[model samples]
Target: MTKKHVHSVTVSTLSDPLPSVAAKTKKTHSVWREYVKSRYLFVMLLPVIIWYAIFAYGPIYGIQLAFKEFHILDGINGSPWVGMENFKYLFFQSPDFWLVMKNTVLLSLYHIVFGFPAPIILAILFNEIRYDLFKRIAQALTYLPHFLSWVVLSGIMFIILSPTTGVVNYVMAAFGLEPIYFLGDQNYFRFTLVISAIWKEIGWGTIIYLAALVSIDTQLYEAAIMDGANRWKQTLHITLPCLLPTIAIMFIFRVGGILDAGFDQVLNLYTPGVFSVGDIIDTFVYRMGISQMQFSLTTAMGLFKNVIAFALVLLTNYLVKRSGQEGLI
Candidate 1:
């Protein structure tokens, strides 16, 4: 074949490859541009990311202590490795572990049973109230306790439950009954924890449901009324239907956190006498890590709690997804 014909043939083959290469280059540049835009937003988030990385994620390295001897002198890095020893101690050697765990679980369960539905009822009640001023007042009153530090809340409980100058004792005296030390009694301590938790945070819980209730179309309620449905029927047929998904999502979160067991409240409210009933994982950690300075043991307990919570989140999410519902993706 002639040299020109060979050259033309070579150019024809080369032309197609040049277009493909140009398209690939354009795609790479486009991706790089988009990545730059995303990086700008990521840069804006850097401060919080760094803070959490330093403080929050940094402590995650301490989780290794659960597997190590964790000498205070050696710190986390130089600590001697002792695989599963801390966990073994926690389960077998520790005297109060089960008792504390039982109390924590029971308290959390009671909160779920009695306290879980309390906010839903309160939301419905608030929704039904005709007077916006009264509704606002009730909402504010309920949420007020959530702001109070556990230290302050415990003081309030102490006053109310005290044998002397306590309103409760005063009422018991009027009824000719002996005064009871509610805070001091082991039997009452768990009850007090659950009830106080409900009282403090139930209003805050109601807020989300209230927001969901607000999102629900008023026309649905009006249509129910026009269809000769009563108030209760309207709630059953319309209000509840709209609230179910929200309730489910919230319930999953509650269940996922079942093992958490209200550390601050229990720690503040508990005394030596009622420690049997009120002590929990968080309090136990404080006792071991702070009061006792058994850092390794405390680390083990914390690691256990986190591992269980992680598993629960995964399981609950799976079940929710299997049920064909949207959950924490």
Candidate 2:
């Protein structure tokens, strides 16, 4: 009986998994255990996960429409394949496509050049303000515009910028200058769009920088002051260096969305007269997709814009890292 029991025990030991397999199984068990312990946290995150799944990722499936000759009656899956014909027309065949692409790229560049730095400057100014009450008031006033929709703000802008009786024209008349048709004239439309976009978003954009400012060590500033550094010198040295990582990350995100040149603002502010200069990818897509029902064409345009934007983000991140700054990656 003892010999039989020893033989059975040896057979069970030989049936056990090898060392590598056992190690993998143990690691997986540890991960599952940690996940079980954090189950409540996952439950808390479930809503956000659901929201993204429903609204963000769910729409991704329709991207195939870009490669199809979509027919409403035939549905997305049933639509006939068109290969690269949509992209071919977008790049070579269509007349307005190149013009729209040019406008989109130029407008995006304008925003990056002018609008990107406005919030950082404003946040620094806000940090320097000594009077708490006055700073709060200033912030509130600037932030109020961000809460208003472009549709509402555009009406306010029309009243203020009217060439005949508007406040802007009235001031110009007082200064012995001619009234400029800011919205109507193609020459001024793009600038107006850029300026208005900066004004509306600058306050909100400062929120992130201001939060980052709070995380900075006060000791750094004290040390700078002890070394006879002035405000400008301290900002140039300590403040900016500390904020560099945040700035690099934010810049990467901004570059990622470079194609999105304020659709709402442009849509509300532009007219037929300014379309040549003010028209952008989003507005063009809106007209083609919704108004004209050229779904396949517009989808191709969207796919193209998104691909370029994604490439820009990757390139920008690489450049930032190469410059010895932290990147979003």
Q: TM-scores, in order shown?
A: 0.87, 0.89
TM-score of 2: 0.89
Question: Could you give candidate 1's per-residue lDDT for residues 1-329 as a string of tens digits?
Answer: 99999999999998989999999999999999998979978898999999999999888877888899978887889989999988998899889899888988898899999999999999999999999899899999999998998999999999998988899899999999998888889877777888888899989989899999999999988888899999999999998889988887887898889888888888888889998888888888887889988898988898898888888888988888788777887
The candidate maximizing lDDT is: 2
Every candidate's lDDT: 0.89, 0.93
The list of candidate 1 runs beyond 4 A from truth reads 1-44
In terms of lDDT, the poorest run of 10 residues in model 2 is 11-20
Which 10-residue window of candidate 1 scores lowest in summed lDDT? 186-195
* Candidate 1 local Cα displacement, residue 161, angstroms: 1.3
Off by over 4 Å in 2: 1-41
lDDT of 1 at 316: 85
